[model samples]
Target: METLIVLDLDETLLYAVQNKLERDEDFKMGSYFIYKRPYLDHFLTLLARDFKLAIWSSADDVYVKQLVERIKPAHITFEFVWGRSRTTKKRKSVTDDYYFVKRLSKIKQKGFKLERTLIIDDTAEKSMLNYGNAVQVAEFTGDPVDDELLQLSNYLQTLKDAENVRIIEKRFWRNG
Candidate 1:
């Protein structure tokens, strides 16, 4: 039973903001400043060992690809990479930024079953369509001490053998 772990880029795995500072940790990629979350590489390495990995970010292709390349090197593996083009176009609200939603229904069209798939994103609204299979983590904002990824890895390890991902997610959501 292979479980799919869908990761969000941008503020979830890394935080990209205006690069006007002189911080050595800041990666000036193109027009934005990107910072790797604390223990990012280790977290990815641990998760990749137990579950099939994939990236499903709302960022544009060029941006997402660049970020993925930086984070997951050749040795690290990813089953799929989906950008804004593959997501459902939906706005958070009238006054909110227009974000493409990660619709599990659409992902199912690509052969990924909801019961075996889990999505981790900072924005709860982005995963609203598949909230049961989503783990809403605290948005990564370049904090050097941030440990959300490590914590998430521990939680996922517990679910790796579960019959259904949603059952475990439901329990967490209730307690959360």
Candidate 2:
């Protein structure tokens, strides 16, 4: 069974240099740019080489696409990038759950189930309370240029072994 790797955009893989929502035609104030955060390329490469990759950010698709292009440059195989347009004040609204759930449900519909699927997100607003197949990486508010990737890396390394997923669940959600 191919594992589905869903990732969040802002603050997970990339930090916004500028408020990404600034480009909104409806924005009365300003927005920013999404910049790559640490462990992004390396982790992405690892996922591409191992599990099937998909991005399920709360942000829109166009914004996510631009970030993907900027980061990978070369086309690394990705299953999908599930996202939505920034048009509301819903805090963490999702417009791509159809794609998100379908991917998982397909595995069930096809008579297969994941031994281990993973999600690396910075917020619980979407993935945590809803998806049982996710690991939330609590957001770190600091200079992006200085944040360390070791914590994320250590967790990823453990995922290579079937027995160590508890580390992911325990650590990711502050899961007590």
Q: What lDDT does the true structure give each of the candidates?
A: 0.82, 0.54
What TM-score number comes out for model 1? 0.89
The alpha-carbon deviation from the true structure for residue 50 of candidate 2, after best TM-score superposition, in angstroms, is 2.5
Give the 10-residue window scoring lowest on summed lDDT in candidate 2. 21-30
List residue ranges in candidate 2 displaced over 4 A: 17-31, 73-75, 85-114, 129-131, 140-142, 145-148, 161-168, 172-176
- Report the lDDT tens digits of candidate 2 across residue range 99-151: 22223443344343455556677765455433656676757433444444446
Please identify model 1 stretches exceeding 4 Å from their true place.
20-22, 92-97, 170-176
Task: Tell me the tens digit of each residue's lDDT in model 1 across 1-176.
Answer: 68888999988988888754446565778877888888788888888888889998998887788889888856778988889988888765768867678887776777878899999899887898886798888888777778887777887888888768886645354234
As a whole number from 0 to 100, the lDDT of residue 104 in candidate 2 is 40
Q: Model 2: clashing residue pairs?
A: 18-32, 18-33, 19-31, 19-32, 20-32, 22-31, 60-84
Candidate 1, residue 90: how far the Cα is off, in Å: 1.8
Every model's TM-score: 0.89, 0.64
Q: Largest TM-score belongs to which candidate?
A: 1
Steric collisions counted per model: 0, 7
**What value of lDDT does candidate 2 attain over all alpha carbons?**
0.54
